[model samples]
Each structure stands twice: as C-alpha cells, then as structure tokens.
Target: MSDEAAGRRPSIRDVARLADVSHQTVSRVINNHPSIRPETRERVLQVMSDLQYRPNRAARALVTSRSQTIGILSSSSTQYGPASSIAAIEAAARERGYWVSTANIEPRDPSSIAAGLAHLMAQSVEGLVVIAPQMRVFRALAAQPLDIPYVTLQSTELDPTHALSVDQMAGARLATRHLIELGHRHIYHLAGPQDWIEAEGRMRGFLEEMSASDIPTTAPILGDWTAEFGYYAGRELLRVRDFTAVFSSNDQMALGLIHAIRDEGLDVPGDISIVGFDDIPESAHFWPPLTTVRQDFAELGRRCVDVLLGPVGDSAPVPATIVPELLVRSSTSAPRPL
Candidate 1:
C-alpha cells in the first residue's frame, strides 16, 4: 500500500484533493446538496469510495451549530391520536435523516409544561413539534417564548403562523348532522374535558350544527375521554331519557356509553342512537360498530415535520390545516316511528 493509503483516516480534504475538487464541493456532495454537477459528484463519490472516507457528523454539527435533531413536546402521548401522530412524526423525521427528542408532559400545571420544554431544549434541538391539546398548554407555551422555530398541532386564532390543525370542529359537526338527518330531533353531546382544545372544537361544532338545524340543543355532558366516564354517564342518563341520540367526543367514551345503555336494557339504534369521533381501531369492532369521524393522524404528523423543516428554517412560518371525514355505520339510524 502507498504511504498515503497507509496514513490515518481520510478527511474531506483528502477526498477533494484526489477528486480534483474544492473541499466545499466535496462537502456539498457529502450533504447530498442539489447544485453539484452529476459528473463531478460521481467522481467525488468514487474517490471517497477509494479512500474509505466518511464525513464526520460531530465536526459538521459543531460548525453548523445544528444537532440535526427535532424535539417533540406531547401532553397526551398515551392517547391514540397523539400517540399515532408522534409515531408518524418520528417516521417522517427518520426519512429525512433527523433525530427526534421527545418529552411527555403528564401534568397540566405550568411547572410541568415548562419542565418538559426545558428538557427538550437541553437536547439542543434545532426545532420543536408541540402536540399539546389543552388550552392551558397553549398558555404555558406562551409564557415561555421559544427561540427555536416550533410547530403546534392545535387550531387556534393565536400564532396562526406556527400552528397546524386537523378540523376537529368540522368532524363534530358532521357527527351531529348525521343524527339530525336521521330524523332525531333530540340529541345529547358527550364532550371532552373543558380545557382541551380538541374538546372545545368538537363541542363548538356540535352546538353550531344543532343551532343551524333548529333543533334544541341539550347541555353536553363533559367526559374525561374514558370508557368508564361513558359508562357512568350512561347510567345517570337512564333516569331521564331526554334525547334520542348521543354524539361522543371520542370512541373510548362511546364504548362506555354503549356498555351503560346496554346495562340499562336499552338497545342502541333501537332506543338511543350514537356517534363518536376518532374512529380508533376498536371502533369498527365495537358491539354494534361505532359510527365515527376519522382524523388522519399519520398525515398530520407528516405535515408537522414538513412544515417545521421548510419555511421554519427560513425563519418564515407556514400553517398547515387538514380536514376530517365522517364514517357512517350501524350505530346510527332514524328514530323509531313516533
């Protein structure tokens, strides 16, 4: 072997010298930059192959001050929607050769949210994706303004440039409208907790749809997005059979509601029709199959990464919005003949 071949590991300059190219051109090729001429790139790559050269990530990051890492701040990571979205975000980031740092905020308090943010910041993330669902989370995020570009997965009038949303409101409206069209004049809404952004959107949609149809809107029962809550709400509802149908904010609650109604010797669609949101995997297998609205969590996650890496790098923010679709099933039907 030649003395040069026997020398220490090859560097960018070594590859550049052998390929008769500038070190900058070599760097561009290493980074897969688009501007390098095809022939030049191929020659540089061949030289690199001959030298067994590998670009040093640490050196590049030190020079760029970019970890090539993104942070994810998720408040409801355990839930199906947020969990699925986070997975998709990770997958998308992987495809782009980016690292993901995740922080799960379990508490709604200001301290917890701040701590979560601080944790991600410590990782030296170049950008952030916030999957915060609660209104309080938005408040907490605002309290500590972030220096790095970030994207929020919520729909609100505030900070439109940094927000991406799935039309939770429209999904709710579709669910309620389905019941209305089925000739059910009286309907109840099972809403998510008061402070959750998604819950608020779903509730607002239900109200708007009910008002538009000239149907009297019964007060919605606030649920904790659990089947237990649904079961309890169902039991209590047995005392007063005021509505012909119920629209739940999520499938989990709908599951509980179904159990409760069945325990009370009531037949779904036969006595009280039902609808739900977030058509989780189990929704299709629910006792009678749940009619629900589906949100493309995967698509939403992909968009979050795209927007963050795009205009965000240019210091220009672009918001992304996706709509939801309603799925009809056996859970809903026209009210029994009066």
Candidate 2:
C-alpha cells in the first residue's frame, strides 16, 4: 500500500485484512451481530483498535438500506425547550441503536423549514421530527405532502395524523388551578410570543380554568418569551394596580418580571404572587424560588422517536401529548384581601 493510503483513517477492509476475517465478518462485528464466535470477536476487536478503525455510518446505511438515523428539523436549537428536547432525543436514539441528524432552520418560515426537511431526506433519514413550536409551521406542514414517517413537537393544531406534543395546555391548567387553590381570584397571564403554540396553549389552559371557575377571562399580557420582554411587561404592569398573581409562559420571562416587580418596590409572594413555566434549571436559585411547570423534553424526544419507528399500521394518526408537572415553590402565596 502507498504511504498515503497507510496514513489515511483505517477502513473496515483494513481491519478485516489485519484480523484474517472477511469484510462481512468485520461488518457483523461492528454491528455487534450475535453469530460471531467469541474468540473471533475478540480478535477482530483487537485488530480494529490497532488499526484505529471507525465504521462509516453512511456506507453502513447504504449497505443495509437502513440509515438508523433520524432527522430533526428545528428552529432555535439553543432555546430551552428545543435544546432540552434535542439532547433528550439524541440520548434516546442512542439507546435504541440509532443516530440523529439535526438541521436548524431559520426563523421557522414554511419555505425554510421545507428546505431543511428536504436536506434531511437527502441524507436518507429513516424518520423526521420537527420541533418548530409555531402555528405557521403546522400550516406549512399542511401545505406539503410529506409521505415519509414524521412527527412534530408541541405544535398548535397539527394534523392529528402526524403530530405529537407535550401537553402545554394541561401544564398551564395545573399552574392556574394551583393558584386558584391558593385563593388567587384575579390572575394575570404573561403570555409568550403570540405566534407560538406553547404560548397559546398555556394561555388557553389558564383561560379555560378561570372560565370553569366563573372567573373573568381578560386578554393576556403579551411578551416574547424573553427576559427582556418580561421585564418590560412587568414594568408596564406596575401602572395597573389590580392583579393578585401573574403566570409567565416561561421561566426567563418570570425572572425578568420578578426583577421588574422588585424594582417597583413590590415584594414577590408578598405584594404579588408569581409563577412560570419550563421549570428551568435556574428557577430554584431565583430570589424567591419560582413555582413552575416542568415539561420533560427528554421524554418528549424519546416518545417522538418511538412513534416514528413503531408501526403506524392502519391506525389513524393520533398525536401524543405529554403532561407536565407543577413544582410548587416560594414564588406563590395567598393574595391579600382587598
């Protein structure tokens, strides 16, 4: 062999030759096939290590006609929900002897999302999972005819046939109901981006609970699910002196709202109670621990994969909704009697 070939990364054929085994045997060993003899397996494994051999995933997929890789199409993979969900999906996929390929789409436009989906398809992904939380994405999905197996994460009104989501509405209800039990009658909701499904679901849940209890359903205060928006909204809220409690769509907004309220000389759980969603890692460390809903993104990821790989059969598409739990903390308290 030329020096150039010798210096290149070791391939399956190299290991096969070194171990005196056929290329098929090496492939089986790489895939952990059960039929390989124990002694032969050890020999092949040692040769692989000596050669520093690594299997080419693409080549393997070509051979087996199974990529064993799922495609994830998402916007803002760095954000709390999508980031956590992606990590969870990766872990879950690894456990199932599969891999993941992620494509981060910009602004979650229908065209851009469609392009990302096409890119994943080109990679020969076995399944697709879309993590765009906006209603527009669902509309885009409706516009396209995706014949491949796919699922969506927490979309607003997705086709029941191809979508799955965490139960954001249920989580919001849990938060609202908890506050009601604490004697908070006039609750204010700090909503996330008006365009996001999660924001809408949480708002809907809060309204539904209030309506069921014969409480008024006022329009929610809109924010962009950012600490800056929360802070700004909180400052504006100080001008209206009527609300007893506030429920933010996510924890970042809650944190900013808390800061804003404190800056206005109002004490948390003393002057006004507060609650947030997502149960972010830092919620416990806030000035007053944040009472929030915990959405298990990891579980969402695992279940998405399950639905994608499992037999859909003749069963109609049924969207899976994972319920979140409410974590009671120091941020909430009984409202002072007016």
TM-score of each: 0.81, 0.89
Q: Give the worst 10-residue stretch by lDDT in candidate 2.
A: 310-319
Q: Model-by-model lDDT, in order?
A: 0.87, 0.86
| lDDT of model 2 at position 163 | 66
| Alpha-carbon deviation at 236 in model 1, angstroms | 0.6
Best by TM-score: 2
lDDT of 2 by residue, 1-338 (tens): 45865988888888888899999999999878999999999999999888778888788878777889999988868789889999998998888878999998875566797888888887789988888887777777677777678887876366776668888889999999999999999889999888788889999999999998999866998888899999998889889868889989999999999999999998999988999999889999998999999998787877887888872357544348777999999999999964
Q: Which stretches of candidate 1 lie over 4 Å from their true place?
A: 1-60, 311-319
Worst 10 residues of 1 by lDDT: 310-319
> lDDT tens digits, residues 1-338, model 1?
34875688888888888899999999889877899999999999999999888878667766567778899998899888888889989988887779788998865578888999999887678889988888778876777989998988874565577888898889999999999999999899999999888999999999999999988887889999999999999899878887789999999999999999999898998999999999899999998999999998877877888887773345544447789999998999989853
Candidate 1, residue 264: CA error in Å?
1.7
